[model samples]
Target: MTAITNKGSGPIIQEIAAVIVENKAYLSEIDGKIGDGDHGVNMAKGFGRASDRISAEDTLTDAMQTLSDVLMAEIGGSMGPLYGMMFSDMADHLEDTDQIDAAVFGAMLRAGLEGVQEIGSASVGDKTLLDTFVPALEAYDSALAGGADFAAALDAMKAAAATGRDSTIDMVAKIGRSARLGERSRGVLDAGATSCCMILTGFADGIKTRLT
Candidate 1:
């Protein structure tokens, strides 16, 4: 029953932001193949802005709220609104929780996923972020149901996120700007899926290190 405290976990978001900022160029490069080529730039901008506002003593909920605000208001592209709503829903789910155990985290993840699904038209296998996000959540839940601890469930989620991201390589773009490319989009990985993998693995790693 490993859990991480809700208090003073804002730095985890900062670390996640750093990961996004550091990979900005690479993400954009991936997007250049099939999309507008601004995914990384927009992601880095929003996450970095949120990181600067988040303090070390702030709660995870507070940090995520800030991230959601920035992403929704400052970043451009469809992802901004999708990710913004996701984080907002996730933070709202954890607003009153003091400890983040497997069950609690799973609820938060589901909230975020639902937020994304509610506002977006894409579904699983659409070669979108849902490709990575849905599988990761399912894996996390399955691991916990199988009697794995919180940390192990997070590991399962991270692995599934990576596999989902990779699965996009062979998928034809079914939505977004890439959809227009049809068959031409099959060989390249979906940029949204890649970034979604980063975010999920970031959460898993951050929580794993804080588990007690």
Candidate 2:
């Protein structure tokens, strides 16, 4: 089985943060279509702060914990709390592991999904982040169960995340502020789904690069 050492994986979190920060304007623009336009600004702020605090030698779990803390305590948007809990749960699941293999990663992904579901009432088709998150997790686990290697599973996950994110474009908002817009929300992509795809894809790419 291929695995990546947790000890030197902190830079992956930094790279994820960079991806968020780089796409700040784009994310907010998506949100501006039907909801508050601060999704990108808030996400970038929280991720940027966490990235600055994470060290090159820090473990992936440690870096994620820092990110969770920053998002939960400093950010003021709904996404902050949701993503904070998700990362917190994911880090907790991986806290004791030295090597991140397919099984371990699947458990971590499940934990994160559970965390998001616990605090939020939205379901898979609600046009929230779960649209992207749920399918990505399913694809990753499905790939692993089908005998794919870690890198291959990550590829499956990344593809699913993108597909799920795009799927949101045709979904009417069933929750959040956008729900008020009803049919008007159908033409635009959900901002949460977009960011979720970026995060999952970033994770997949990072893990694939570190797999050994």
Candidate 3:
């Protein structure tokens, strides 16, 4: 009911990992309606392992790399590679920054999206995670361009993500197994986009306490 607040990525990542753990069963229940039903379990296991690997001495890249490694090795199903690619690409782009500003952070998200594009070949409106991710990243960029502060930009990004997630309910799935359902997919929200929004929104909410 309240706004998502965030600070740095470290504690937030840990919180995200925790969220995955807490919601694993619920996520699977949603996925069962339209997907393989293993998405929730895979995501939770991946993030939980990554959390144990993160540390205060670690950088964002380090945290992301740890996430990538865990997901790539341990996570199963299509969601593994897709989520892993995003975090890995984000880490690759962020190697140069110790602390990211709003613009820089937005660009990092762009890099992550590009990774997803490279792997999934899906774009916005295709009813994939990109539907939520691309819009959220773009919203972050737009808000920063409009002279909004970090918190404001993050707020816009989170809002756009929620909207994008909701939009999927009206769209016919254009890729993956759900696409096979044709018009039936129109009324059901995309599990991938919903989960992606949850991750991003969780970061925004958790960072409020950690960022200075």
Give candidate 1 regions above 4 Å deviation.
Answer: none
CA-lDDT, candidates in order: 0.93, 0.94, 0.80
Give the TM-score of each candidate. 0.98, 0.98, 0.91
Off by over 4 Å in 3: 1-9
Candidate 1 lDDT over residue span 97-171, tens digit each: 898888999999999999999989998998999999999999999999999999889999999999999999999
Per-residue lDDT of candidate 3, residues 1-212 (tens digit): 21222223555677788888898998887677777788788888899989998876566677888898888888857878888998899888978575666666777788888888898877789888998998898898888889887878889999999999999989888899888888877887788898899888986676544445
Candidate 1: C-alpha lDDT: 0.93
Error of 3 at 120 (Å): 0.5
What TM-score should be assigned to candidate 2?
0.98
Give me the runs in candidate 2 sitting further than 4 Å from their true place.
Answer: none
